[model samples]
Target: MPPTIEMTTTWERTCEVADLEPGWGEVALLGTHQVALVRITDEEVYAVTHHDPHTGAPVMARGIVGSRGDRPTIASPLHKEVYDLGTGECFTDPGLALRTYRTRIVGGMIEVELDR
Candidate 1:
């Protein structure tokens, strides 16, 4: 079990690290907020608000994960908009991106850091 990382005020037990397969994604509800947690690599994971940056709809979790010139990204299934998995920066447009959250694993549990 890894040591827990204290971020913000409340601590959340989101998912188990083993439960998340690398290169795959998962959606979990933390409180009233729906979030998409994506595993981009063996040690890198991204937690983004499930709402789409373009439509404000919860669909980012269904987006496809891929890479563009070594930049890991997710292509929105709704509009095909590409977002950087690491930074949540949109690739198709200059100023479009989904809100990103901080994530860490503690005791094999995935924890998300959200602003309360």
Candidate 2:
């Protein structure tokens, strides 16, 4: 039998919580990936890929922040594709999906867990 090895995930600190405005998305560079950081409230923040899956353009930071029912969503500025901020599920297109990252706040700073 082979020994089991455990993997640990590292969280990268992006910015201060005060740096993001509510209902707006900001772009943060994580290594070679561009992430769109959106703050829904003082304690709620979401991190998603800045690349638009439908258009293959990096314009997700300019997306409009809104809500569908109780779910927080962002609509692409280019094609108006709505995506769930928490799950990365696209509402406009069944074949398209957005990439989402895990986010957390610690000591007044925003941290994101990027999949490398």
Candidate 3:
């Protein structure tokens, strides 16, 4: 058995549950970090570093969401680089990836897990 990793809630309620429609991405500031919270499907929500992994630009949150084969990904609006929403892994470079956060909806509010 492995040691259990504890997940702690980081972000406060940035937006109401109604504020996020299905299949959309929004930028929210959690502490000092900017995060891109995306609704991939009706049941799935993903949180990733808003900065574009390729250009070091803060614009992934505005990227369009789609799938490459079966992997749900977001295409950067600046350079069209695709990243896996779940893992924040660059589709072109596996070694290059974004930091991903745990996201959950509770009491009609959405929160992202933060590293303390």
* Model 2 misplaced stretches (Cα beyond 4 Å): 1-8
**Please, what is the whole-model Cα lDDT of each candidate in the order they appear?**
0.83, 0.95, 0.80
lDDT of 1 by residue, 25-52 (tens): 7899999889898986556778888898
- Residue-wise lDDT of candidate 2 within 1-116, one digit each (tens)? 99988776779999999999999999999888899999999899999999999988999999999999999999999999999999999998988899999999999999999765
TM-score of each: 0.84, 0.92, 0.81
List pairs with backbone clashes in candidate 2.
none
Error of 2 at 41 (Å): 0.3
Compose the digit string of candidate 3's lDDT tens values, residues 1-116. Answer: 99999865555666655777667789999888899888865457888899987788999888888888888888889878788888788887776787888877877677788876
After TM-score superposition, the amount by which residue 21's alpha carbon in candidate 2 deviates from its true location, in angstroms, is 0.7
RMSD of each: 7.2, 2.3, 4.3
Q: Candidate 1: lDDT over CA atoms?
A: 0.83
Runs off by more than 4 Å, candidate 1: 1-8
* Total clashes for model 1: 0
